[model samples]
Target: MDKRLLDILCCPVTKSPVRLLAENELLALNRAIAADQVLNGAGARVTGAFSGGLITRDARTIYRVEDDIPVMLADEAVATSQLTDFPRS
Candidate 1:
């Protein structure tokens, strides 16, 4: 991801600052089983967000990652809380 781009990205819902997780960090986060893991829409997996993944502490909304670029459009994000509950197969 580009710093210039990241400097301009914001959370979809809160419109707040976002942090980009490293690939390994994302992988580890993806592996986490939140207390409500089974209730999230995307399930408990970080595959959707990785080195190129952007997250806001307010919520786990994830913008799309394409070509190593994170799509920070509000409409293109998935909440982290919502994503941290899917069963990985």
Candidate 2:
């Protein structure tokens, strides 16, 4: 993701600043998705793993990046709290 774009993007729901998800964080998220344990805020099961993602600065939510495009919809946001064994690093 471009630095300028990241600087301007914010979580659609909380209006909070957004940042790229760290490698470990992405790994943890993917792990959960692989287990079919992750869901969007709209209660829809997340069927695919994210190749890239933007996480809210507060770390409460994540928006997936597909084909290098960020999916910023609130209903598509995945709650970070839902992932078990989330990596701290």
Best by lDDT: 2
What is the per-residue lDDT of model 1 for residues 23-54, given as tens digits with 9 covering 90 to 100? 65455455553322322233333333233567
TM-score computed on alpha carbons, candidate 1: 0.53
Off by over 4 Å in 2: none
lDDT of 2 by residue, 1-85 (tens): 7899888999887799998999999999999999999999899999998999999988889999988789999999999899887
lDDT of 2: 0.90
Q: Candidate 1 has which clashing residue pairs, if any? A: 30-46, 37-85, 43-85, 43-86, 44-85, 44-86, 60-79, 60-80, 61-79, 61-80
Worst 10 residues of 2 by lDDT: 80-89
lDDT of 2 at 16: 99
Residue pairs that clash (backbone atoms under 3 angstroms), model 2: none
Report the Cα lDDT for residue 23, model 2: 91
The parts of candidate 1 lying over 4 Å away from their true place are 29-51, 57-59, 83-89
